[model samples]
Target: MTINIVVGAAIIRDGRLLAAQRAEPAELAGGWEFPGGKVDSGESDEDALVRECHEELGVKVALGDRVGGDWPLSAGSVLRVWTAGLVEGEPRALEHLELRWLGRDELGTVGWLPGDLPVVEAIAAYLG
Candidate 1:
């Protein structure tokens, strides 16, 4: 089976990024990751991010830069991550067990999903 996961980094005004804790376990259980999920077939990347963000964080995003493109996870899952700004609604932990706003220095404090460490670095660079 092929698993295509599209993720997004909702960067807040304070230079912190948003991450969500997965509610299910296949891999990276209990670990934090960028807020996003699988992109439906024929769905645009940005569209997927928007939908996923609303579903997971209860917030609407004003799309920002494409910090980077998709990268393959060690689990063979592909992730499409984007950089977005908060537009409307406050971020609430909906699907996730918890949600956090993490600064670059604080990013390493969380137990991130397997492939998300690299993504953190990439996002940090993009933010700089």
Candidate 2:
């Protein structure tokens, strides 16, 4: 099976992390996630994170360090996460149901997608 690499962005500002609510793919609907998407062929993870944030959140983000190691996704795909800072424009829910900023104390309150849980933990640890 071919492996697809997906990138997720943990965009932080004012000591809060941006969380997006998924609105599609029925199964993932209403699940919270860091804004990002699949990396295209020949595209670097950083490039893909930037592109995905633009496409999904209507914002430009400056990427920071990688978060946790790769987490597995359905269909032979792996999900990788990175920390990011907003560089231009505010994040709008261009593709999601809603967007919320969660403080380190509130991170555990949202219903994160299963594939995102590990990344969430990593972010929580990084923020502490």
State each model's CA lDDT, in order: 0.78, 0.91
Candidate 2 pairs with clashing backbones: none
- lDDT of candidate 2? 0.91
Report the lDDT tens digits of candidate 2 across residue range 13-86: 98899999999999899999989998999999899999999999888899999986889878789999988999
User: What's model 1's lDDT at 8?
Assistant: 68
User: Which residue pairs in candidate 1 have backbone atoms (N, alpha carbon, C) closer than 3 angstroms, thus clashing?
Assistant: none
Off by over 4 Å in 2: none
TM-score of 1: 0.86
- What's the distance in Å from true for residue 128, model 1? 7.1
Off by over 4 Å in 1: 1-5, 74-76, 126-128
